[model samples]
Target: MINQLLLRFKLLKDDKTLIIVMTLMALGLTLVFSSSMSGNYRPEVMLVDSDNTSESREFINELKLSRLLRYTETDEANAIKNIETGMSIGGLVIDQGFSDMMRNGKEINLSILRSKDSIELIQLRSDVQTTAFKFMSKFKTADMTVDIIKGEGFKVVEDELFEETYALSTYYWRYRNPFNLNSQVMDAQKDWAYNPMIHYLIGFTLFFSTFTIVFVGSDILKEKQQKTWQRKLVSPVSNTVIISSLLIVTFIVGMLQVGIIVLIGNYFLDINWGMNIGLMLIVFAAFVYAFTAIGLVVAGLAKTIEQLGAIVPIILVSSAMLGGTMWPLEIIQSKILLTLANLMPHKWAMQIISQTSAYGLNVSNFITSVLVLIAMGTVYLLIGLKLSKRHVY
Candidate 1:
């Protein structure tokens, strides 16, 4: 086994196609990683302060502090134009009497111009409204308290009632104080910190795996049709040597793809691969071997190159959907769909990768994933080998 493995390695070293694939994979990975990590999702916010008061200034300053809102102060017309032209997602307009309205305990009209409904924009609007309301409540409470102390009996009206209600609402909303235990408990969920990266990685990995498998598998069929297999069989190379060499070629190709993604993610995207890269590498290597073995099985079973080509796309698309590549499984409310996703190898690999990347997951879970991949590869390879032995024609 050792000699066969060495000879296979040497054959892979001489394969120019393997070297080219590795180089291309490295380049692609670097680019994708850089693009994702560049902080493109945070939208630009235009602030139009027509009031130019202390309140407006404070609001603008608050918006500036939020990492989500990339604030740019501009005139109302320009802000509206920016939003309409898609240069900015939304614009905040603080009206002329905003500060005076709050001071006089009157309703203030704040205008928000948005091209369309978006969750980020809604969240920003909610935060701004809450801050404004809190400021107004504090101002009203202080003013009314002074009036009451001065023996102004008429000032002890519903305005005073409003102050108490506002205080209570703020306290409850801010701290969840006097906790309402009756709220229904929900099932535990995976943490969302790794959602974006994990989903993207799974999609890319599955796509690549399927493509490599089909491409390499079809090549085997082509060789068989051209009698190239027979020519190799007549040489000093045994059947084991040929099979091992082919497996090594696939393994090298798979690693190259992974390396491309990692390099892109690390250098350009500025994403941390994980705390323990060695463990990640080990897991990834095992996954590559599993995919290669599966490809070999497909090739061994397939009578023609066209048959392999037809099957690859089905595997890629199916695996991607089942693996939570299209969307995060957390948002999928269907319990059945979530349960079914567990059947996919891609899903399991993604779960392990996400947990290790975002959180400091223990080594045991990573090792388990590696072992599972190895077992899968072993099973596929054994089946392929058994089928190959009966290929007398």
Candidate 2:
């Protein structure tokens, strides 16, 4: 077994096709990591001051202090126009009676106009609510001080209105932070989801895996057409030995492919792959084996290298679409499509790898995913072997 594995490893080392695959994988990972990790946040806010009261002006002043928010004060009409034209992501409207309502203990109305960007909208809304609460808290505290000195409930109604405003705004803050709060609390790490290195690594890994199958399978077909496969079949090696040798070679080549890409991501792109290196290696091995089995099945069944080459792109594109390579699966709200995503092995593998990298290995999930991958590989290998038996013709 050791001798066979070593021989296969040497075969892969000399294979130009494997070298090209690894090079392409590395290049793809680099490009993806660079693009995805860059921050996408631009806090452009348009403030519409219909009230133009002292309290509203003070509120806008407080908001302007936030480094994340870029404020442009415009009248209600202009603010609406700017938002409609996509000149700003957020538009804050302070109603004409906003200040009077607070002073008179009446409900104050405010409006937020936002573009179609849900993330930016949610973030800006939360920031506005927070600023409003801070301002109201200061105002209430001052009012309480005056009441204590005067020994009367002066502006008690105003304080009541402030409380009402705070209460109403609390609902908007509920979904403000969609990223994992626990992870943030534990590590004080921001940009949890937008980490370019990690996202790119995962996306590229999946993309490369799906694409490489075609090339690898085509190489096998080419070798067969060149009569290299006939030479292997006549050797004293058993069919199991030959197949195992091929799989071992492919697995090692795959690992090297992933390792080089990961190294580039870590050093050049600054992607944190988390602390569990051993677990990552295990997951990578499993994904490679499973995908290689898929390639083997393709190679075994393909009548010609050209046929294998032509079919691989379709399979890869389909897998990428289903596995959330083009976009995160969380964005897909369709229950039926989401349910179908669960059935995709690429999706499962990508999810398992991503979760493992971010949150460390979830023992149960990791084990289950590994088992599934192995099962898939076993099924494909069985089918390939059955087909290979017919190669005697």
Candidate 3:
């Protein structure tokens, strides 16, 4: 076993294979972080006011106070053009007589254009309706108050009541509205931080790390190509010893790559993998073991390096896609696809990583993921060894 381990290391140390391994790791890390940390999503919108009245200007100003959207003022023609050309995500065209309609208690019409449907546009529309409702509520309250005052046989001036109500509502809105709605930042941390990029990084890291398995498994195909396996089969070294040695070397290499990725993510990208570094490593170790086992199964099934090269990518890529390595499982709306993803070991491993890294969860929170990986590795390794014993090559 020891001789086999040393021999495998010597073979892997060859410049070409070593370069491919290092290059893949470096490329994966770069892409993961670069794509993750690039920028945040902020929806842009154009507000076109055909009225240009004080009421319309005030409405636009109220919208400006929203953190939900970035608003720009533009002419109706330009706003339509922008929405159509996708320069702005959406547009709000406040029609003429907007103020007059509000004063007369008539429904105000608006021409809304959206470049694409999204939650941001939906929220923006809600905000617009909310602002209009609030403004109209002041007028409604003043009218009701005047009616009550006149019913008591006291003379009430309509203009004076409206002005007072508007002023009072504006004052309360700006400074002291006891009943006003507010959103506060909760003291407790969110389960997952709003960083899709970090999820992408971790998911892609797990997905790309499987490539190490494929690369290491290719050693079997290499031995066959060079007729080295024939000599080794007749040697005093037992087949079990040879296979164990290969797995050990591959696991070490795989863990090393995973560690480097974690370190780079921490130091370069400033990602927090959680307080329990040791547990995270354990999860990674189990995942790497399972990934290596998958490679062994692929190697056992393939007859040549060409076959390994062709089929291993299809297998790993499909696993990555189905296993939520390309995106989060939460984003996958299809129940069937999600159920299929659950059957993948990669999905479990990714869940472990996500819980630990993104959610700041303790190791104890997802010991099941670790156990699942171990079980999967055991099953795959058993199948791989059985196929390997056939030795069709």
- Candidate topping lDDT: 3
Worst 10 residues of 3 by lDDT: 188-197
Instruction: Order candidates by lDDT, high to low.
Output: 3, 2, 1
Candidate 2's residue-wise lDDT over 1-393, tens digit each?
A: 788777655655446675676567646765755554345645678888888887888778878876556888887778778888988886988888888876665655788886564445666777888887766666655555545745664545655655555444433334343235553335534232335456556777667755554464345566677887788779887767877777766776777776767666667766656535567667767777777878877777777767877877787777777877665676576898888777666777778767756775578998998788788778877887777654522
Report lDDT per candidate. 0.67, 0.68, 0.75
Clashes of each: 9, 1, 0
List residue ranges in candidate 2 displaced over 4 A: 1-7, 10-194, 356-361, 390-393
Measured over all alpha carbons after superposition, the RMSD of each candidate to the real structure, in angstroms, is 9.3, 7.0, 6.3
lDDT of 3 at 41: 45
Question: Alpha carbon lDDT of residue 204, candidate 1?
Answer: 68
Which residue pairs show backbone clashes in model 3? none
| lDDT by residue for model 3 (1-393), tens | 677888888877653465356546654665755563345545678988999987788778777876667889988888888889988878988899998997778997887787655445666788778877776776567667777888899876877876687678778876887385766545543333534445666676677778876678657767866778767889898888888888898888888777877777667766666545577788889988997888888888888778887887798889889998765676566899989987788798778777666556665657888898899999999998887764544
TM-score comparison, 1 vs 3, better candidate: 3
